[model samples]
Target: MIKKFTLFLLLVLPISAFAQRFSQYFSSTMVESFENPAQGIFKPDTTKMMAFNFFVPNLSASAYTTGNATTTLKQYLFLHNSTFPNIYVGRNNFNTLSTNNNIYVGMFKMFADLAGKQEIGFSWQIRAEGTAHFTDETVQLFDGGTNFNNLQPYTNLFNDRYYAQGYHQFSFTYRETLSPKFSVGYKISALSGIAYDNTTINQSDIIFNKNQSDGTSALYLNLIGQHRTSYTPGSFAANNVVPNFKNPGLSVSFGVEQHNEDGVHIQYNIKDLGFIHWGSDPHIYNFNHTDTIGLSSGNAGQNVYNGASFITQQGGENKSFTTVTNGLAEISATKYFWLDGEKQFKYNPILVASKQLFYNGIAGAFINNVQYGKVTVGVMGTYDDLKQFNLGGKIMFKSANAEVFLGTEQLLTSYDMFRAHRGNLNYINSNANFTGAGIFFGFALKFGADVESPANASSIPMGEDEGFLKRTFKNIFGKKPKDYINSPGATSP
Candidate 1:
């Protein structure tokens, strides 16, 4: 179980993708704009008519492990140590592991109308989200059955759960203004699932009885579990990661912005609410203990493993399934301040709370940024529902025509992880409650005719001809733009 779990966890880390780029969330970069749908990418007087990444991927990825498995996982995963990780059995204790990344393979956005407030965008990206939980007893059973000889029985110790999904996202995003202060945006996406793996053991119990006459141990295991995956064990293929319609899905994101007159910015979003259907014949297993072996052989542990295999075989099924995407809802506000009375020296503090739908994940972050002209540095403190606390920082260079940034959300813990990977054995004893790392970087450019505000435009006189979105869906949303959306609304788009 330990070996198998390790393999699965490793696979999920590299291939899986999902990200909440906090620093970039308000940066107004092409990636951030598409993510929010209601966020604008073009400013009439400053930015170009179009924005794109030219296939240069703007990406962020992160993974973390918690509970008693932290130390041993670091040693084995980073240092290639052969030592089995320590585990605390008998209690309903478990360890957790998660990995996420969001990669924009390519994106192109344009001003659909003369009014800078109306814009349309298209993008191709990859996204994923996942988490897993495993009990110490499960790890112990696979770690040479360290204490199985004892005359004790255990129940529910082997219960565990894992679920992860990854897919390609092709999106069409639209944003428009209501009355200059309030704007709305939405993104509709077609999704192609790349991978899906889910399994849960809701109940399990084990008892070992030894026959002193021949030292033959009788074993009994009662388990109930359901497992589902895109492919069978040893059948995972490279083509699975490539984009395809075999597993199709859809999602949509809606956003609203309130532009405050006092140099304050606020935005609300309902992002990625949708589902996917796995059309291919996925592998499924339903274990219920009826297939358990009669008795243990000379090697008691060997029989346990064999019994598990038998149940897996008896319960295996090939079928299709449906699953929901990891949707999100968030609201954020930022107050901007200019220091030194130069406007070039600026300070802004932001508060954001993000919650996940159909998943047990949420976070609240407080960010402080200081900027000097085109360069800005930010500090962030965040806490998540998983009880993890993090500190991170980022640096960005943004201008009217181009933007670039780099940062991490798990700075302190990532340092320990870095040390472990650097062959610093001392990291094994670090006092960090968890182990994780995150990194993100982005680059984008804008081109074409400079978007001109009404006062500076040479085009026809501006009138009450509303934007395309507002005209097309007038009844759907009848509101004025009292607020604007985009990262650094206090700065240029």
Candidate 2:
């Protein structure tokens, strides 16, 4: 039984495709000095500056099968239980659910000037970013069979499956100022690790057989097997499997900021220009090709072909496959202006154009301002390949010296054709419409005061007596002081 199951796993494993989507958070934002090379511009005033930021996002979707062909949901169910029956499944029906969550923490400090210029400041920044995803699926069989009779006499069969993935990254950035209004920065990052766990449970009495006479018979066996078995939860448990996953990559960026005499400030940056490859390589598996003939009760002697064949049965036949690498790139710019000279009231409306250099492109904008001294508001819009267009807004309040940003992104594009295809299936098909959208919310806070500017040098002072004596000696000589001094100090006069 173990060997048969192992063979089954090997056969179906290559059929599953895993594609990691680019993060919207990473896409919509501009590249910081840490990720770009043109970091030798704009300087932040850290003399009394402190900041904090946070982001949260959620996405949910479903779709009906296109035409009569098997959808991703159906394929998943069929792979797990080859004998399960298919029923009507639509956009409202959810055979699988996947959720992703992320959190980010950033902090920095600036001190000490380089090259004897107060305009040149150095700072150290650390960023801690984490991501977690949970996927739950429930597959149901439409076939009426006793093979799943353990749960019910002769009715519906269902299975519940769960999957989880998590990872974290810690990075450090160094920023240096080149001018009073411009600075450049670079960041070196190392990913500590990553992990993925998946679990599948057959709630019905369905059993999968390497050899089954018909579809109905296969479904019945799968149902019966599921009813007789119990699965334990945890990584690598008898019922759970964990895949080896890790991400290693380098990121470089450059940014520039300029403040005109009119107090109009603009900033631009490019970021995340790197790639991450999963450790797993691609391979093809051969399914058993033997056919089984009937061994009916009346027919005592009948040849049956179970379609069983060895991997080399077809004269070393092999299939080719390759794994896809995941990577991202982005460019963004923003403009800020003060509504008041005192800088108490500031209007920062920014336009951003960004693209995943390797995967996708997105463009958006945001407007932020302070009203009532403690409240802030922002509105944003973005276009995505899967969700066409998205519109959302956020409101924030400062309390206890902490600031929070609460807003949604891609709200309008969640139900488009793009979302239906990619979100439902792990694979990207050319025929699939790619306009899908997702939403996210983020927060940032400021802490500590900006550092003080360096002290200025004072002019040198001379004694009044020296000035008076020089004037008196010049008058007595009736000539220029230079001539008197050159004449041996007026001959001891």
Candidate 3:
């Protein structure tokens, strides 16, 4: 039982993926309160408003293969349907295999204002995240069948790593305008961990030798490693899904924004900046088991044979350790262009770049958004270092007291799923690897302040120093001039 469980835990779970939706930039939905706190004050209304957002969930996953393999999700899934060779190993080099899955459910989120100038929000979320990485040598030993005996003597192989955690989050946010052009916002989160596990390898190797006399030969093995697991018993059961507070953590997200007279805005944000320290009572396993086993008949002048596997497992004393939260760093610029002389209709072009600091993933996107009256639409093109290329869009309707939106990062897959084709399942028949795909659908109900008019809303009041400097510059120049740097309007199309 222990051996089976160890193998499952070490080899099954994989890495993580980013769950953020790029369409949020154009939706103008209340969920932006969580995505970018500074947005809390951007609407034109001054009256206090309240809103609840639901079903805004995002999922991300990816598979790792040989350097020359098909890395895209669609291509990999197609390949999986047909003929595929055994694991590919680089010549005298280590081949890597990795996988990650991460999901976020908004559960329930709402935002309200302490006053017209200040916004406050709260949310409850559930998350499942994990990652697994291994090397070719490890794969050959376990999956190669008879190939295990062919390992070169004294060859060094290092290839075993994994981490997984599950938890629930409660968050609170506050945002306020420092000046009309400047605003700052931040969120504080408390996490209740449900489960956790990780493993680190120290040393592993195999040695082969043959006896000179009529006897059975033996192979020598040495393995060393440590692992940790923690969970409140029964916490994962369907009927007892609540995690205990015995293992809790805290984190913070903070950001600032500045926009000028034209529709141009610049913003910077750092999110999920914290860590979780597993409780002192977590379980620990240290492996140091090794043995020599004989193979072949002893009647031969010399026989070579051995079969010994299974790492020793033992309970460990209570010790606490920390795991960093999935943090992110982001910077973006957005410019709006008016489509009509009335300024009631406009389009915005946005460019954003972001990084998952903890997972070492980078992503960027370009989005074009058009809003006229109560309807807004957006299209986006996105890519990430993880080999994901996505084209998606969003459509939304807003009223004085409500908003609804539907969007997908995998629009093509969603369309295929709805058509006569087998949807993404088509790739499953091939020898392809399905990396990741998801859809986002959610709605918001609002109460208070009338819906602000996007075209007629007044801009933030200028800071005293800013106004004085601008006036002075205009006087010296004989006429007010364009602010190429801090101006609000577009620098280009």
- Candidate topping lDDT: 1
Per-candidate TM-score against the hidden true structure = 0.88, 0.45, 0.69
Q: What lDDT tens digits, residue by residue, belong to model 1 across residues 144-191? A: 454566667677788888778889999999888765557788999999
Best of the two (2, 3) by TM-score: 3
lDDT of 1 at 177: 76
- The TM-score-based order of candidates, best leading, equals 1, 3, 2
Q: TM-score winner between 1 and 3, please give it.
A: 1
Best of the two (1, 3) by lDDT: 1
Candidate 1 stretches greater than 4 Å from native? 1-4, 11-19, 82-86, 207-222, 290-310, 461-464, 472-493
lDDT for each residue of candidate 2 in 1-493, tens digit (9 for 90 to 100) = 2123222222222111111122222121212222343332222332224333422212211111222122323333324222223333222232322233333434332332332121212222222121111111122222122222343322222333333333333445545444445444445544322333233333223233324555323322221111001111112242122222233434454454544446544545555333333233211222222232233332211111121112112222222222122233444444555677676664555555555454333444443433345665665654543333445555656443354444455344344435434445333221322222334443443445543333321333233322232345557867544355347535411
TM-score of 2: 0.45
Better model by lDDT: candidate 1 vs candidate 2: 1
What is candidate 1's TM-score against the reference? 0.88
Per-candidate Cα RMSD to the true structure, in Å, reads 5.1, 18.1, 8.8
